[model samples]
Target chain A: MTALASDTRASRQPISFALLAQVILIANSFIMLYPVVVMVLSAFKTTGEIFDHPFALPDFTQVGNFTKVLGETEMPTYFMNSILVTGTSVILILVLGTMAGYAVARYESRTNTFILLFFLAGLMLPLKLAVIPLFILLRDLGLLDSRWSLIVTYTAIGLPSAVFIMAGFLRTLPLELEDAARIDGASEPRIMWSVMLPLARPPMAIAAIQNAVPIWNDFFFPLVFIQTDERKTLPQGLTTFMGEYTTDWGMLFAGLTIAAAPITLLYIVLSRQFIQGMTAGAVK
Target chain B: MLVSHKQAPSLKRQLWVAFLVVPPIAFMSLFVVYPILSAFAYAFYDWQGLARGEFVGLKNFREVLFGATMAPVVWNAFLHNVYALIALMVIQNGGGFVLAWLLYKEPFGFRFHRIAVFVPVVLSTIIVGFLWKLFLNPNFGIVNQALYALGLDSWAKPWLGDSSTALGALILANAWHFIGFPTLVYLAGMQRIPPEIIEAARLDGTNEWQLLKNIVWPLVAPSTTILFTLLFIGAFNWFEIPYVMVGLDGSPFGSTDVLGLVFYRTAFGNQSASIQNFGLGSALATLLFLFIVVFASMLTLWLRRREIQF
Candidate 1:
């Protein structure tokens, strides 16, 4: 009877330790979420109310920030451009990256090795290093101000990491599945699409989220490639908002809140997969 | 010999491979390779808008290497990168590793601690930048508010404005945002170590300290090498955060003028000095490329030596 109680006490100690640890973690998470929460609340506060009592509960009197953000600026246009650019770029990267990754993983040929190195080399080469000549090239193509130009640049940039992650994932997948598919009247493309890609979800999801986060947050590419206000994406749009209203902290925070919402919400929902995917990509 | 007999299958496979590889190759060559080569070509000529001048040979490279204005900018950028590297390798990486070590033993509440600290990792750099900007704002920012509340009003200064603190401020913000990444990576790496190894050490009268020093650290070396290399790349490509916080000129006294910012200013900014320096800009970019490529190659070599492939 003493031993039983002792066993329960011992277990309870670890549980109590765990509970304390959780409180600390919760407090830390609140610190992490503080700025995000502040921005979200800022988006709902009136300009006057924001400064009059910055930390107070935002007045339910007005939800004016969103209306102003949507109405007063080219934010809608920027949002559409962002979607088009990110969507098209991600598709191209996935398709091309998958094929390239598969070919590199499957074939043990010298040419395949060279191709892998060719793309992998770009992984270390910073995009800023190419900005000088890129500008000249785009100008010559008369694509400097165009949305598609940035899309093209983004696709190229996204491909290297995409290929690396996909290749790693492909290598780990059992080869027997492909061999069987090939034996069972499946062509290579059909095999990849039907058999391999469907199973490559773990890495693909990793690649997508990894690639998506950067593309969504990217400032440098759009900064250089797209000069026109109408063609700008969210980062550039936010910068424009900052330029016009540097002193308007409330509006600036509101704009930032809009920009941060989607990615943060997505991370909250998909964090487990996100972390797993990220670590998998990094280790590979 | 068997595949030679199956001509239809071989031809179809080849065709499919070609189809898959061609579009990406073409797209890459057009935007990536072509632009890079054009930058190389521009380095050999003097172009003052609309491709105006004769071949300058190595003059642009000479000016960038030997000229008065160009040398300091390059030095400043290199120094900035080194400072950032030190901060990331020391403060962020060190802090993260320590935290990870402490949290490794699933002592009640481990899950919450992991999730809380890692939230910063998922945020966009732009968002992180703006978030920190607001937090550090001199007037209405919470930082000042806290300082004043604690009766340390004189302790607060304009974080992004003062040249002395601007770079350091940016570094702190960056470290906060990215430290979680390496922590998680290290944690994942440590988790992969066989439990028996750790248990064996403990059973052999090894304390927690000895177990960690002998068993865990050695096992995590490969991951450490990879993390360091990646952090090096990230440091070298320091952009977005500085750009958002400090703008194109890297304000105050150009304290935050990283290589990325320098390249952007030279290539695209609407400054009179920047307007006619395409050749010089290309040369500078070429030099920056060589730096990163060489750095990456060296890291890969170092990584190969350290990698204990399990």
Candidate 2:
């Protein structure tokens, strides 16, 4: 169905007008990329140089800011904490959400519909609204300043969407596989663990990426629950860095770059996966 | 024995279901449900530090909604959130549609444009906020610097410093950060349109505008429903951007104040005042949550029904 009508009309438009549209897109891409590039460049310049020529190409050899940020600050510690917390949260979310999603998708229980809706409700109402009691509850439990505070909160926050994505995906898998496994004398848990779970890798990755990014980037939970310096994640820790070096432009930009680098690099490499993961919910 | 053989697996399935859903359900009940429920409970009590002092009934809710001191600030913050919501829906989502339409028509640089538009979206909100804050700095920021360079010096003012332009500046920064989300959503929607339908429309001598309006816009409804629901929630829960850029006080005389900031300041008082009042904060949180859930669900249902009609 090659559409001659639409193509002819598209071609009939003036070439210059079409060129203008292309240029606008290119210009937009430039605009989107430009600010971040300038920030990276500013990270290489001294405070004085930044004030003088903010846009000039900086000498790449001046790695002083990076060394100072990495050495003097707890940025590395924050990165480690972020990784640990985000990893644990994503794993928990994937496990719990998958089990629940599988149940809703495959099982013929009377409560499946209600159970699926229960998880779906979490998607609409944000967890931040519960901060008042959450703070009190965390402090009472003596988990206020621990990494577990973030881990638990994040798992709870992420479970709904993870469940949604998984259930939607699992329903599309043929029931014959499960039936075959059952006929082969595979135990219920064994079937799920061996056959279904492995096949669920794509949605699991989507769930992992979706949850990991937010947990890694979360500042509010750390700001609320984790009061100690050792427990702060990158986003909150970056704020601490900013507050400490208010006058040092190069160092601040360096800190920003450090905070942004991991995800940006990961995204650049796995951009298709990232896009698919984030917009997964919308499509479904 | 034969009946038992058939019943055994059914019983086993029940156990499996319990194992699968119980822990996650319990986990959610403990963390998400408990806190939300406790928020409602706390709304009725008075607090001293972390401890509940007395049962205050509707006092806290009254103070949050209608008190002489808190009412004005709360409403003001509420209005700012609404303004941001409307601005973002119009600017960010609207711009996204235009971009998606352009890309759908012109295949040149399709791959690059798709990836590039979404780059900022996946970045940390904290980074986006800090980057924009730095960009909008009065003297040395690139925004003003670029304006000056382009001989638009008269247009460059202290964007965040001036109260009048402060909220608008934050909204623009937000739009810049998230415009790609709607772009991707709308693009996906536009791509799903069958080419034959478009061809049939074109054969009738319909122009691009008519095609977009009559054909594309209506079909983008599903995306619209999702994006609208998300934007509404994001706007109302808008915290990180204003908090990072303008600071907790919503400074420059509180022009950028939002409900989240007010709730934060109220729940756990800031540097200026340290008198924490959990009661009033819970009341405020309860009201905000209820408002969001009720209205957003209604809006979604309405949009969904409209989608069916379209």
Candidate 3:
């Protein structure tokens, strides 16, 4: 009887341990998400109601807050600019990063290490270090106040990491596939395009998401380079709603919702891919 | 698909590669490299954007280091960064590691927890700053409300308004924003650990805690090194969180004025001011670059020495 009871106690310990872990995880996750949830709920409330019932759900769902955000702010224009900048940047990064990765991976000259090191140096130079110079150069080129400024900046910024990922991916690809393409009298660029680029869809998708999210969320570039309200991106535009009326939590939250909704929605729909891509970079 | 450059592209193909590559390189050099170089040159010339002064070699460096006012401000910012780094490493990374470890076990309904924790990471830092600004409001903020409910109303101070706690408060918020990335990274690292190793330890009568301390941790050291180094570098060069939360001047006695914020403030001079002191700004930028390089080198050396290969 004593032996049996001891055995049961030992068996119950793992189950209890797992239960403890579950409780901790659930609690941590709730706390992590509580602020955002409050923001979302506040977006549906009036300014008075948001403060009146701080922890409660909005008394009623109101699309009015979002409408107010859209009407009062330059959100639509910012959204379009974000889309244009992020799209162009990602496309350029995909093409150039792939080509650079191909060259670095395939070529084994004294220049290979130097080229890789050149790109790697960027990872060390924080954006602030270059912010001053970039501003002046952009102004000189008449590129300030345009979405193209951000596009070019984002491309340069995104290149090093994109190349890093693509290089790792390209190295993993089998040599035989390219060999056959070469044997068929396909030119080098043709082989890269027809043979390797398609095979690189996984890493490309990863790089695209990794590049797009931050570019979409960037405020500093638009804050400095973009001088006018009409050229503002979502993040930069959201700050317009913050001048002393930060107490009007409802409208502010609504603006935040407008700014954050797309990314959050995409995160929900494609979380597995998001997690996969993020983890791939971390693990590598 | 490795190939030699000797299997070189034809002239037309070379032209295509050149077309694709040269534009980006030129763009990078023009926007990134030129500005940096110009900033360096500006450091020597004592110009105030209008009248160009003769080159005063190392004068700016001497002023930046020994000048009473800016020197103290720079030192204070550096100290704040260190405080932020310690807080983030302990609170954010440590909490994240625990969560990742829990999720790795994959208890029933673990997927929901993983997704929820990571959700805030995708949101913009601006949004995060604004969100926390509201939540920490002493009057109607939920934090204060919760404190009042618990009869601890005295404890609920104006979080962002107070200089001493303002930087700390933003540190927590910044940690919240970035915690997910490190969590996911650690989780991924933990996943790569061979399951049989755990099974072997378990069969040897090892408890879960013992198994973790002995078998799991040593192998995850590489990820830890990467996480520690990256977070250190990120925290050392911190800007956006404090900038958006505390404003450009690092307000309420300038408690949160990290090097990046100071540099930005000098360059652009905020909305209230019109002075664009390009010389001082570039000098600040140069100082910031030097600071980061020195800090990163020391950190990398420390981390690399400890990085264990399993």
Candidate 4:
């Protein structure tokens, strides 16, 4: 009886330790969520109310701040521009990257290895340093101040990682599928498109999400390359808008909330895939 | 009778491979490789925006490194970047490792904790910057409010306004935004450890602390190396946070200035300087590039030597 009692006590110790860990994690998560939650909530409050009752729940009837942000500002145009740029860049990266990744993964040669290393070297090249010459190059090409410049630059920047991820993923798929497809008289492109591309979807999604977030949120390139207010992406627009409306706390909060909404909603909806995709690149 | 088989790929397959590979290579080389090389070339020339100036050999470099007026700003920004590196290494990565270990134990609500922790990472840094700017507002900010509510009113101050606390505040905000990245990476590393080895260690009378210190940490060295390399590179390239939270000048007496901001301000003048200096900017950019390359290589080599093969 004493032995059984001791066994139960020993088991209870670990359970208690786990429970303590749970408490710590929950508290830390609250700290993580606090600022974001406050931002979202403050979007609905008047500036005076925000200053008066910063922590209290606002009366739900006042959503004029959000309306003002969307209706009065150029936010909707910025949103469209962001969507267009990010979507187009992501598509270009995935298509070109998958093609290159497939070639490198399928062909085993010294040249292919060299090509792989070339792309991998880009992972650490500090491309931000190239901004000056890139400016010159774009100007020389008459591509300055165009959204196409951002799209093209984003695609170039995103390609290395996308190719890296796609190549790693393609190498894992069994070779027999390709062989079988080849034996069935399917061309190499046909095999790649019909057989391999389908298998490559998960990694494609991972690479897309990984690259898409940065492209959508990128402010540096837009700040440098974009000249006009109408062409500004969300981050640049928000920065400019905030500069003009720095004292209008309610509108600033609403503007921030609008800027963060799409990606936040996507993250909440696909948090699992998002986490898995991000961690997948890190682990390998 | 054995059928004759061609081992090497046919000409059609070669064309197909070229078709697959050529476009990305061309695009990357044209945009990425060419621009970087040209930037290096431009560092030596005394060119302003579009006009080709005299070929001044290493004059721009000398001025950027040793000139009377610009050198102090350059050195100050470099030191701030070094501080960012140390702070992130100690606070962000260190905290991430601890949280990863806790999450690895699969405590109650681990899934929720995992998802919630990474929430800030997905948001734009501009938004994160603005959010924190509001939260650290002196009059109506929640940080000061909470401090006062807890009777620690003396501890609260204007976080972004004061020079002494500005860089530290920016570092804290950066760490908060990125802690999720290292946590998830380290958690993945910890999950890769074989369970039976842990069981065997436990049976051999090792305490949890001992196991973690001896077995778990060594196995997670890959994740550590990755995090360190990334943090090191990111430190040198720090810009958006300071640019948004402060300004291009890295305001409040330039306490929060970073190398990236220095380069930006030099290239595209702000309140301080109205005229753009392209040659000096290229020199600064080249210096940044070289610093990242050399330091990252050395760090990777050192960290790679420490990785234990299990």
**lDDT by residue for model 3 over B58-114, one digit each (tens)?**
877666667776678777887888888899989888877877888888988888988
Q: Score chain B of each candidate by TM-score.
A: 0.90, 0.95, 0.90, 0.95
Clashes of each: 2, 0, 0, 0
Clashing pairs in 3: none
**In candidate 2, which residue pairs clash?**
none
Prediction 2 TM-score vs. true: 0.95
lDDT of 2 by residue, B1-310 (tens): 1122224347768898899989999999888888988889999999998889889899999998999999999999999999999999999989899888878875688889888989889888899999998889899888998899899999999999999999999999888888888998899888888888888998997777898898888888888999899898899999999999999989888899999999999998998998889999999999998999899989999998757332
RMSD of 3: 2.9
Candidate of highest DockQ: 4
| Candidate 1 lDDT, A1-284, residue by residue in tens | 99999888866864775565566555655776676777778767766666666677776556577777778978788788888888888887888888888877764545677777878766655665777677767888888889878777888888888888888778887767877776776767787889988888777777777777777777777877777899998888878887787777667777887777777778778878777766665664
Name model 2 segments beyond 4 Å from true: A1-17, B1-10, B308-310
Better of 2 and 3 by DockQ: 2
Classify candidate 2 by CAPRI docking class.
medium
Error of 1 at A69 (Å): 1.1
Q: Give TM-scores for every candidate, taking all chains together and pairing residue i with residue i.
A: 0.89, 0.95, 0.92, 0.95
Candidate 1 TM-score over all chains jointly: 0.89
Across residues A250-276, which tens digit of lDDT does each residue of candidate 4 receive? 899899989999999999999988887
User: In candidate 4, what are the lDDT values of residues B1-310, reduced to their tens digit?
Assistant: 2211125777877888899899999999999999989998888888766665988989999999999999999999999999999999988899899899999988778889999899998988999888888888887889998898899989999989999899999999998899999999999999988989888998997767898899998889999998999899999999999998888889889899999999998888887577788899999999888888898989988988878877
Output the lDDT of residue B239, model 1.
Answer: 82
